[model samples]
Target chain A: MPVTKMIEPILPVEKLTYLENFGHSLRAASYLYKPSSADEIFDVFKVAKQNHLTVTLRGAGRSYNDAALNGAGIIMDLTRMNKILDWNPETGMITVEPGVTLEKLWQHVLPDGWWPPVVSGTMTTTLGGCLGMNIHGKNNYRMGPIGEHVQEFTALLPTGAVMTCSPEKNGDLFYSMISGMGMLGVFTSITLKMKRVYSGLLRVKAYPVSNLHNHLNEIFLAAPDHDYTVGWLDATAGGSGMGRGQIHAAKYLHEGEDPDPQKTLRVEYQTLPATMFGFFPKASIHYFMTPFFNNPGVKLVNTAKYIAGLRKGEHLQSHAAFHFLLDYVPNWELGYGKNGLIQYQSFLPKETAEATWNEILTISQKKGMPSYLGVTKRHRPDKFLLSHAVDGFSLALDFKITIGSRDKMYAMLQDFDRIVLQAGGRFYFAKNSETSSETALQFLGEETVKRFKALKHRTDPDNLLESNLYRRVFGS
Target chain B: MPSTNRNSATPLKPGKCAIIVGSAKGLGGALARKLAREGFVLGLVDRNSELLVQLCAEINAGNVGQAFPYVQDVTSYEEVPALFQKILVDLGGLDTFIYVAGILLPTTPTTYDFEKDRLMISVNALGALAWFNVVAPVFQALHSGHIVGISSVAGDRGRVGNPGYNSSKAALTTYLEALRNRLSRYGVHVLTVKPGFMDTDMLKSSPRTFWVVSPEQAAEDVYKALRQRRQTIYTLGRWGWIMFIIRHVPSVIFRRLSL
Candidate 1:
């Protein structure tokens, strides 16, 4: 007798652990499916619909919190669906699958004298994730969020219908999906307009400032002329040196001045060894600096970094090297130990940015929860329904989570949220891990939240698309 | 083919040209499509003529680059040189040659069948060598080109699951290493790609599949490695460390473990 073989579906449901955006917290999903194509994703939605289970789409799992995690249902991991669908060099238009990372996109296009119009600090994030968050780069003040570069996209709705959306077609859905945080649907493909660059080199200049006022002034003055501008703040700097930092400004070098042609066109992605940060051992830093989660130790380290920045006045850098400085030290977050870290970013209007930032720094100093890392960038408003941008500035802070300071950290963040709300500021959902739904409602205005909720109800009527972040922030 | 300089600011006129064996399906087919999108004229060769013609039609439909199909069995070692000559002549030139044809036999050391073992050796080991014998000399004459061979991580160490398949890959790996050693002085690059478990037809029946990557992911990794001119790479890259640890395990302890 011969045995009869049974063939199973390519993607099978399996139990998996889900990590929050910052990797500080984790949960388990009842079922997880890693689909390699849009059709497979459609099957996943079908299964979710049939089983009456919610579905959450995850891409590269880089959202600092619960944006891509679903505690009670299924997770569709889209990392494997990465593919460059098409590229039209003459029009400077490129089409890519949702799973393609920014690093991959840049590498593919840079050699052809083209580049993405907007890119966030980390290059590992997926293009789909960037669109979901509507991420802003250092050049946000000049270029706006990544959504502005998007020409059109094909999205798979929860009802298993695929629709092509653009600014001119399906305009309502297009607006909602840009910053809808994946509540709208899953994007299968996106076509973006790319910017032309003569070379990958950037002419960089660093200006050190003493306080928040000086930092803002320098950024304001530098924004008009520079293509990219950002500030690195020393959160532990107190008293006379409050909010002190360095403002780094950069622009692409002209064709003739780009030093090495081979390097400028075909620059290889460079990575550091796990133990090496520049020449120093990162493991030694983690071991020796474990006890420095305190105010004074953090202050000393920040001061050292500030002095180092001051010494590096002017230099030429690869765009990747300049934009992805945080990734240079591999597993640097391990320095925070097992508890992980939390990142909180708030966007305030230009009129109230300086005052709100001063109060926020003062609050952090009083609470003695000095952020280990801080960055500030200018921005302008966009048309996305859940847009986080304002004609102002955003301050992002990273706090190391420790056993003793966890509660204090949450309380401090709550206080910060209150201050931000009082100043008419909004929060970035991509970086938030612990914001309450009430706070989220206030951060996004009541009317805007209502409109987004109504759109979600219409698009995902059965509410099949769900995530932990969605539950916490939208009360769904 | 066009003489495209990747480093130049000027765009490629007709783009680079590539010859990919076993491109009718699976990883090879995926790579062919990707290279086509990257503006590469393609020479797609496979034993399955039906799939080969269909794939060529699909790639040609895009009109990004022209796709030429050749039906030839890799195991027919003597026909490889002639096939290569035909592809080069049809495509005008070749800048990249990728060999992705290989067979996996279900033969353990104890239950091995002679025919399966022989077929595995012929397709997985000799077939790659046959292609290399023809392509390497042309690349050396041209003084500029890249050759990529898709081996497997299973070659890193011999195990009980399938000794014949593992040994064939081990042979391919060493052959590619020797080619790399000899070709570097001539500016001809040889890259050996050792992929972990990829979700391809070969692994459809395997029960112990873990950390399996999609074929598209494998193709993407291969393209990136070729761009960087890496000597060797592990697709889904973590497999490099996994194989490193597996290869360094003490023999006495390794014998007792089930792989």
Candidate 2:
């Protein structure tokens, strides 16, 4: 028998391990390769192709869905390649390998008076993951997504081509690949323009909103003056209290506002405290919070939070303290227990934001599976082909899952997708786990899907790159 | 028990050494006989020392090929590496390896025996992986060999009768498929055997059975599949279509059936 020549025995059975999404709900048994350089990543791709296996790209594996899982295939984990290649504090320009995290980036440039232009709610996310999903922050309405700040990038294509893309050169690829969700190629290097900061502290303000209408109106109007604006809604509230929440808006201090900039800018002063109340380790807070993971328990907490916000306050908060509330209690997601949790986030135009969300919140409460936490952010549209943003507002709801409630939760989320699509809304792939292929087609349209497929054909004719998310959202 | 050479005057084919795991009784012993009849130098491994000695004596009486018996429990995964190397050295060189070691504990819809389930999985699933991991690199270096794994048709669907057995077989079936996909390019053949009902001690106490075959007949079928280098086979063949339908039955309906 004439056998086809295969790559050498580089992938061993011992390399088999489980790769799970940030939510821990989606996972796969994959052959994991932690590559430290572009050449090593290429070797992994070669091995995957030779063995007729698909390769999924992973950077910190922070996606909440199946975006980073390739079941029974190969996963190229690029976190080992973390390296800050170049930095220019004078011009606020920096170049880095794909694996560098927001925590590393901020730590590297805070003393130089520069900050990442856009960052996720958690500081542990990688730059590659941020760009792959085109993540946005509370300032999305003004700053767009992280991809908008990327000046240029170089990627290793499955076709064995090292291509450099920018707005002026290979602009089509530059736009699409950023939001391609790691299907186009593996990013080797990325150049970005960081926002210059005068101080390490942000002036903050907090207040309460009465209902869904007030919540949308306040954020839409406040986004222009504030550098960051976010809202926390009570998903269990209903009947005149629907979408009732509190909004926190923050703005950067001017050069002269912070009298002790030198002291505040120091990494030690800006880092989050490791312990709470000077004694309790923050790592174990999740265990204490686990008792309140149920609907009735969470409702009480949300009510207490809303009542506390009614006091109305303003104060200067450290940049890290203001941006990384999700990191306050380490492994807080574990509070939801073994089944984990899922976030269903939808972006709707300003015209239908209030009504659509009102219906969603009411239905969830009626079903007795209300979300534990609801976060709202203002967003403006972007140029990425697979863009999830809209010229309106986005609401993300986190629901606790149990073995008895999993199937019902998924069915309810599908209903939410229907309502969002009917209102001309879009969804962020990184957040939602249960969106069907038809929902994706409805949101992205036939023209954009065709164009994406054409690009995939040119870059990877053999179709060697795939993920559980890709197959779920776009048909196999 | 000690390793004994039978038909020492018979000259074995070059590189025709084979090892039959669980080769003391039932399907394993029958397959060993078939391979010996085909002029292979055989290594027989099993935990039942008395049965191992008896089977070795029976094969030695044929005086056609050689047999070497090694007493081993497949569940002792830690001992697999050294024993595998010893078998390779004792037989000179290995061209084929068949892992048929498995256990079926009594289970019903109402029973949830963690001890029994854990033992079955450890022996049937993880044991195959431990031995196969050692065998894979050797065959990859040689760029040619045969790996036969005995899975089961019970893995085709999730039945309520035997959750642990079904899951273990499902894990083995999927692992064998991955091995076949990876090793085929190196000219190494990996065959997955999914047998239906068999008239052996493992299933003799069951009340209802269908399409049951004798151990000798099943062994012949497996030998033919190895010779033909088939990727997967269902001994008695009809189980393939039966499983194809069973696998497609909607879960809501399938769950209501006793099966």
Candidate 3:
């Protein structure tokens, strides 16, 4: 009996050194493997112990850098483990393997009058990755995050054993595993709490605000009563018209609101398009319709989009629109053309927002490139390891990606990062790409980092995994 | 850089979850995993989807906190607010929110660029304020939590390199001061982190620096400050001292110096 056959399906074991990352920008060459079972996971760990090879896990291949790419070690692919074991609508709980995508879970449970309690920005994110990341969704103000709703899970401990963890049993490991970002162990199957929904259609109101205060105070106050909410700040506007932008808030209107008899027969929220996962980024630049904005004046077209939104008969399909809204407007980012695109977002403490915004805008004038649009919103930070949220305001900007961008953006990023840090605020990692590693450590600290390394050693003592980001932050 | 036993040297274990907003591959990312090893979970918030998902998964395998990755323009009130609410349900609420999300415009010395100025303000100051409005109530209501913001030496006064960033940081510092004063009574600790020069991807992409500290080291300092609840912490410690003098410098002397 060769010890690697039955367990072989759990993980793909390949002795290669030059493993490239998801973004195709970072590469690590060592060993690659994909494990689909708990025993196989342990076997991979056992091999690493015997071979003294570092280890790292791979999911969906959605990460930008090297989180899933283990160099000079084993890259365990959890994709094949995708499975939905159990789902109970009454209890609002569902169980599945780590590889399950929120999209897949939607297909299994949405039709049964249940929805994943919360979803990340995208549908393709894996359940294990979601649990590892403790993802939050559009209804965060009321629902919180994915970790909050998780009831229990089975994670392969770094000690080469499978353990069950939750708030009650091995609660510490449960908390650690849910938000640990794979530092604690590999999650095999997890039971997630779900949410109740009345219908598949959502009625959204897109109203405009003129300044930051209203956007924060008025908008966030209505989170609980509303099922879904979001607002946009005009980064290009200022002075008396600070928050003069759009706020698009939505909620499921219930079946009675629509009164469509055809919708009454168990309207199942359709699964997201598979291509969406593969089509992560479609557009390059955030350019306005130059043809419309420039308007050569020769062609007369009646486009009243600048005035208000929606036509006479139009409502969004809750399941399809929210997750696939960007998909409908395909290649919208391409409007910026050759310059590419730049998307920026920042968060500041509530207290000094007015003054800090003034200073930042005062400085922004120096940069030749400026955003045409902006949006402001509120965020409540979660406990998931490196989450980015706080009691404050967040503003986003879109620009044409350009050549001097690195320098142009870094200067502002540095200043903005420093300001938020000093103001008892933090930045959003999802929207950033140029923050310096040194500054990154400053915000988190070195001691905490060391503990992370030690924990990794204790869990996977043999070091069988690696990722681009892992090497970047912990390689030394 | 040599590793430090963060708890022994400073304070705090590594089992908490930290939210780093501007953490794709810089200071925010460094702090994210640093704390992850410290036994803390990671919640990475950023607009860069590619970077956000990848980074979160990497950290997930290393720790137990179940790093959650959220993609939203931090500045977008609709996107981030909803994200936070979802996080509340997902991660079981707040432990710490590390505000590292920000953007840099061109460094020219002109205020005529209306668009650039607007972005600077929106991304730097307004976004920060929006986040605060949402989390303050949560932390205050819970009666315990921490709000850590990343500030800079440039914010002390109008800097020559980029006045927009200088002003943004200045505003952030002042805002946090006010927020700390208000939220302290409710058991929410507010920490202001200031670093002189950080060796992040941003710095690596730019000119080499002698004073720059690696993102990992910077992350350690942040964790230290959070554990100790140091209200106003400078990552390198010495940076605080350096800025102390710089802040008090009169306009005449300060403006005259090339620094």
Candidate 4:
């Protein structure tokens, strides 16, 4: 789609994906810009701001769970503004456009023996998205979210004004913007602090946990000290004193563990087509595409797969493979079919961990609804305006929308809110759907919300960049 | 129960208690839909508020029977018991406990990307336990209940991708096996699932390897397996023999094999 041709139908498209912050997935209407100059990037946002359309800035669509989605207006996809503006090899710091992917950043820095300090679960997500989300990596307990790694950056507010801010300069905007859930503005570029790397090989340790309690103990034990650690739970197993089902811990490896550090480190992962990839989230792909029962197909492949698994483990990386991983699994969302999907992530105080997990499970057991990727992790408190992290544990889950049950899901969520509020937990701004005013009231309180309201009034008074989240929480 | 409409309008089947851990969406979402159709009340738990809200809206329209959603970290052991009690107090009992809450980490080799492994271990391993830690006592107190777990067939053995996932699943299956053994004495049904591939977001977002089943189909299969009290069943069925061999393969050979 040529930029000029694609720009015509910007408003009428019905399938827009609204992100959490000011951005949206208006790919259908928004023209893909391949700007040869930064001036052009600014021009895109300027035109949208002047046209009275909602404007959002986006990097690689990696701001998970709609943090990067906005539908009421134009989305300025910064993916094209990826240029390395500056680099300090000695300081291990680099400044680049908001569109530069962490993977792309590594390509340049890794050769010089450096690496980005923080990263998300996957590599395909963009550096700008990382900043905008202020993502927390596996080593967060030790390093904090991605925001702590940056020196400064540029964000363009809805007024078409670009501001360069950092901890020392425009600190309020800096704090509010990084993990601001993309509410403040769009990031044009960032100067991120990178970590020095050695062998680039990651030496790992896996612990088998019997149950949730043990997992938490191990997680926190590793949290204050370990360089990198995370824990996964087997939500399916329910029994007394059941431990060892968990595999929890990892640390970067040193030299000679892998025969060739350079080769292993640099190997790029190219995603295979859906035909070869088994875990794609498409309903048709999983349901109709298979000749046998879905479970049976998975089982049938297990024996042959067991052998294949060992063959791949021998390979290690001096540098992590990023684009190759995503490239191999292109457009995997087709598997979800047309109904689309939803991902939910939230946190609760560590003290309430036991009551919360049990309550959810007990409810799930009664409901007979089982989520696919049940994940659990710990987090330290974060100061980002509306960042999801608190001084407790967090969990993220995936869900698929069906033909006629969205309402049921909504009702269930309301009660869940009561329990979370009772536990003194708040919804992650990046991941919530419809938090009741009552629940929102509890978290934000009338006074805090009033203050934020005052701030929002001062900054985006027109509510120029509106979103589903904004309407649900702020009633903007 | 006899007159309950397990269809589009009144999606739940009455009398069946369901605990949907990751019931926020996809297979879990579809499972909730099916269970609701069967007249079963749902206890939906998810990290995504949007989906949870959407779910509540879908079920609460026209003043249908009520359901409560608990925003929780299923992996937190202490929270599990109270959750069980609340569900019992609110909905009155525990008939089924399904751990569906999960986050998809990109399926990559564990050695190179330790984060992926750590995540797989945590979500698949500890997250699964979040349900068990809470429910083990509830079912034991009740003296009889069903524990239906969504264990992936990937856990059967290591594959070319995501050994972390595979290991987590395998460990989950093993733990479930042990749990089933312990629970069987008290008349509890422990049914473990090895779904090959389901048309869920995780599958959609990742590279496609298997022709997946719709969440409805997967949910239907799971429901049947739970009702029949099958100790272990392959979701797609085709993956059964493969996993059977993988499960029994010698440790040396297994370790030598590529995941």
Best-matching candidate per TM-score: 2
Error of 1 at B239 (Å): 53
Better of 2 and 3 by TM-score: 2
Please give the lDDT score at residue A88 for candidate 1: 84
Best candidate according to lDDT: 2
Q: What is the TM-score of chain A alone in each candidate?
A: 0.93, 0.97, 0.76, 0.79
DockQ of 3: 0.01
Q: How high is the TM-score of chain A in model 2?
A: 0.97
| Backbone collisions counted per model | 4, 0, 221, 190
For model 1, residues B159-247, the per-residue Cα lDDT tens digits are: 98888788899999999999999989989899999999899999975768889999999999999999999999998799999999999
Candidate 3 structure quality by residue, lDDT tens digits, A212-277: 666666567656567766765554454675544556666776756656523532434353433435
Q: Residue-wise lDDT of candidate 3 within B1-259, one digit each (tens)? A: 1111011100011134456777787888888777776656556788898988998788777633457777778667545555665454334235788787666675554445666656777777777877777667666655667998887766788866677777888888899999999999978899988887787644543343557777788888888888888889886778878888988899999888756
Could you tell me which 10 consecutive residues in candidate 4 chain A have the lowest summed lDDT? A22-31
Per-model TM-score on C-alpha atoms:
0.62, 0.68, 0.54, 0.55
lDDT of each: 0.80, 0.85, 0.62, 0.61
Worst 10 residues of 1 chain A by lDDT: A4-13
The lowest-lDDT stretch of 10 consecutive residues in candidate 2 chain A is A1-10
Report the Cα lDDT for residue B153, model 1. 95
Regions more than 4 Å wrong, model 3: A1-32, A46-53, A63-74, A236-243, A254-316, A329-347, A353-365, A369-376, A396-403, A428-431, A436-457, A462-466, A471-476, B1-259
Q: Compare candidates 1 and 2 on TM-score and give the better one.
A: 2
Native interface contact recovery, all models:
0.00, 0.00, 0.00, 0.00
TM-score for candidate 4: 0.55
